[model samples]
Target: MAATVVQLTESKKQIQHTHQVFDTQKQAFRNNPMPSLLERKENLNRLKRALLANKDRLVDAIDRDFTCRSKDESLIAEIMPSIQGINYTLKHLSGWMKPSKRHVSILFQPASNKVSYQPKGVVGVIVPWNYPLYLAVGPLVASLAAGNRTMIKMSEFTPHTSALFKEIIDSIFAEDLVSVITGEADVAADFSERPFDHLLFTGSTSVGKLVMSAAARNLTPVTLELGGKSPAIISPDVPMADAAERIAFGKAFNAGQTCVAPDYVLCPTDRIQAFVDDFRARFTEMYPGLKDNNDYTAIINERQYERLQSYLEDALAKGAELIELNTANENMKDSTRKLPLTLVLNTTPDMKVMQDEIFGPILPVVGYNSLDEAIHYINDRARPLALYFFGYDKDQQQHVVNNTHSGGMCINDSLMHVAQDDLPFGGVGDSGMGHYHGKEGFLTFSHHRAIFAKQKFNSGKLVYAPYGKAVHKLVYKLFIR
Candidate 1:
């Protein structure tokens, strides 16, 4: 934590510098392949200090990058989870790094079995624009704690925040230990193609495929944190007022840019209107002014803004009822990409709003006659990253938890599961492939090598190659049988 942090300038040699940093880190890891516990703790400590020191700076940078990212949202979503991840890793490193003992059979009585957790040389992390700092630092927390070197690739869309990230990282780590690569598509492609020991990607499902392909050439293992159409199911037993507010909070936070944000709601056919009314009321209570409120976050860029607008337009044209949740009733058609929350009802399965992952503050309420039908509706689509069930009945909640399959699920809640360090945060199947939080993250970046050690009394010599007649038959009869 006391090391002098390097001051970095933007590199003009995008691809070349990437290769150079990779080689440099590989050599550094080779020089000290197994960093001591003290060394690893110090690395984590430095990151903690860096995050605490630059808390405000990171908030400002993201606000500039996005038209107006809410300060509280940045603090809660980006900074808070990041600091928690670091703290959780530091708390449990002692036991997690210890070699675990395993059972050995009587035939191997003279020997003992144990699995050692070793570092995976260098790790490559590709950060997406949506949650740049959290994605980068979350993996960094795991990689460094597991005693591996790391290199990060920032998204091109958020150049300002990416550059600021590069600056902050330079202050804490040498490029050889942790380097940040910032450039357009070409640089990102080259960065992913590097032969790192382990690679982790947090982005869309399509780009995850490309990264996995690139990692395949070198036989490098990858952990992809991709996104899908995550859904929320409200049981008929629950009150619409409570269910709607929780769903509204999750959708409105970050303007629904979160990967695990509830994509759509499945309500009892009789209560669909009530759910819509409750959601609108809660949203209005939260943000009284839509256009000028600083607490309300804006979309990241013009392209994303237009994409959301198109979805709204398409839904309206396809006979879907549109209700804009603009509590203030102000005109938000200005240049600022702050979109008011909108609800689309009577949406068909064919509409783009229902087909795509809505990464905006638009919620589509799909009505279902039976709870089984709602679960079936979700299962019919691609597996989602997260699922939520809002109901007071314990048996119904348990049934939902048992029947549905997703990366993670919350009973009567949305978006809180990801914040828990004790629980792993990741996706399943199409949503994502691996996990990275707490011990799971540590294990993902580590290689558990099995070792069997024997004493001077070598009992296994009884079955040596010279004993192919009597001893071999006895061994087969004893152990193999």
Candidate 2:
């Protein structure tokens, strides 16, 4: 009973703090509605400097959070992409800031039309545990580039990294401009309920729904970067070596915790054995050791480790064939929490691994007879965040591009498309909605308001409100079509 009371008290306090911070930012935004281009550039540069300055610290902090997070993976996935995004936004910001001119119709001659991009005040960013630094800063880059005050809610799961980021942000930005909050699920719930101009969430689809529901009270616009069963299809034309090597890289990186990681692979039934052998060989070459190796990252924690174990167990119990790809061939029954990348064959729809998002180093390989069967298999499921195809045929590539539904599609690639500075990264349907990363990101956080200008002479006087008039009828007859 006392614990319950304490929990309630804590929840109330977190709610109060969120409201107080939001109010401060709201008033600050009202004082200076539109930030100048120079000011926005300055902000983006400042953030970039901070991130680069703390690159080592971020790596260390994330290592502590994940226990055995690979330094190279952290640098490649988190720091590099963040710097790239900031640079991309900086290069294109000036042109994006300009007012886009629109042609005025003949009926509205003597008037000019253009769209001015305006910042939405006080954006709320909710960062998930996996890749905390990158996720937080990705939205921050977009929101800051668009000239909006931002408040970030760090995931409670990553306590070490969250605390480090809080310190970094506090030292760099004032409370009115930007701030970070650290708390548990109650705090996240409270943070979402606050009325911000825009809210972006990156996590599971279930939690995204709750976040959207809370934001709906204020009609807050949202950009959801949710995850689902993203698939990598191995076309019949591609060799097993080429296809498996690429798929192995995407799934093995960060132990397959990435939102856009290849969750499963669809292979031709005749070539399943070749695909399995090639994938195992590729993963072994990438990391010669699995347990107690810095090159191979461990699961984030015991809970996640056990959850993955359950998936493996369930797959086995349901008669799915398992091939553990531990190159070292070490005993994995210890408490280190490092899991070998395993491929589960003969996966059925009823199996738990097939039913849930395997955010681990587990790949389910399903056999398909033809391209139509493979396309139907994908379409039958919830829309994914990313779809990868390993083929060089232009006609088949175009067919897959037109027939499939996903947030993004990669041809002859796996996860590199999200790194492109020119492309818009987002999901379509159940995987996620909305995009960020480059111009689309800036536009996502900014409002493109339309403005129409007219001459001093009132042309509308000809159509003033009254009973039917000759000028009104003649004008309508001339222009209504």
Candidate 3:
């Protein structure tokens, strides 16, 4: 399939369509309202059933796009996690939606304070291709639960999967409530220009900036889920084999296409060989048949595949040692767009591979003599979306966690930290900004209105009438700080 490009242009017809969709949905949302807790629970249950029923189709579509999406990986990584999020939201929505009570000061004893949670009218979600199903539904669940209507724009790179997803969602919900828009980049660019109460985008940092700029025209609040070069630090205390296994699984999952996937690993010089050996063994054991393996995903498109190829070639030319966990045999090469699960060693800061986010199955193993060096190396770059530390020591873990800031952290593991529905998922600085999932997701689409209710009272009126000297002292004592 050829890449479809769409350039957004200003036209009366286009603007009218955008406004019509927005206003229609906004009205539906305002009148029908978000479901009651029972309704939400029922809808979630329905969604879970739909996923269960369409699991094979969904997996197949992802495989078609990636060339190798593992069934178990898809179930665990996308389907189950989404179901878990839905269950979490269903279980907690009532409490999350309830009005919060606030304290009234002695001077305002006659008044009561409270906060009401109101939904943001419309939400726009721009999803990425790497993990299309999970990213699309994750934010959709949050937006729906928060009583907001959603318009989801799927990535153009994976058009097949995007079309399939649109079909699935269109079958499930009314277009006015939860609609899917599938087109080229121009459609997305135009969609981003539409007026929305809140916008959540998950993609590259460059695209995130464009989304933000487009959204700014309408003063729409946005949550940018952009990617950065996330680092995984292997501590000396942890067994090299065990650390490698965890890190390898994360980096290899979805062909290391995850936004939070470990882009590079920081390990002590001595343990590099041990880590490499363990990773190789695990990669073979995990997917015994590489070529026809439906478990590993392909790079989303030819451009990305070529981009990764370029990075590998550049790293090799720059004198970085490339070790593949699984080599492309005749069977593998003929049937799949299988990329070698590789580790690059002796990578210097000057190298091109080290300069950007790999976003592929290439893992650069940078050696450091000490933990301080590792920490310093990671801190010097733009803070990532996630910081992964694998160690058992309490103090060392705390030191790393406290001294560095990322969108989130995983101690002794990678990527799994994001599965915790209780934790807020987001990024910091260049990694991205704003948070969602669980209560944070609810709050992300909610407006908290502070309310102060008062009854007719006599004591507060002293300063309002006659301007007396004694009343000034009392008023000053009550309010002046």
lDDT of each: 0.90, 0.91, 0.84
The best candidate in terms of lDDT = 2
Per-residue lDDT of 260-346 in model 3, one digit per residue for the tens? Answer: 999999998999888888888877777665666667777777788889889988989889999876644435455556787889999
lDDT, candidate 1, at 381 = 82
> Any runs in candidate 1 off by more than 4 Å, and if so which?
1-12, 466-468
What is the Cα-based lDDT of residue 285 in candidate 1? 91
Q: Could you tell me the TM-score of candidate 1?
A: 0.96
lDDT of 2 by residue, 1-481 (tens): 9998997887788778889999999999999999998999999999999999999999999999998899999999899999999999999999989999999887777789999999999999999988999999999999998999999999888999999999999998999999998878999988999989999999999999999999999899989999999999998888789999999999999999888899999999999999988988888889888887897888898898899999999999999999999767899788377899999999999998898889999999999999889999999999999999998888889889999999988998889998998899998888888999899999999999999999897787778889499988899899878
Error of 2 at 433 (Å): 1.3
The residue pairs found clashing in candidate 3 are 6-186, 66-298, 68-296, 69-294, 70-294, 70-295
Which candidate leads the pack in TM-score? 2
Candidate ordering by lDDT (highest first) = 2, 1, 3
On residues 1-481, what C-alpha lDDT tens digit does candidate 1 reach at each position?
A: 2221211223337888898899999999999999988899999999999899999999999989987889999999899999989888888999999999999999888789999999999999999998878888999999999999999999998888899889988989988898888987778888889998999999899999999999999999999999999899999879889999999999999999999999999999999889988988898999999787889989999999999999999999999999999866798887499988899999997899998889999989999998889988988888999999999999888888888899999888899999999898889999989898999999999999999999799988777787668989988998775
Which RMSD does model 2 reach against the true structure? 1.5
Worst 10 residues of 3 by lDDT: 1-10
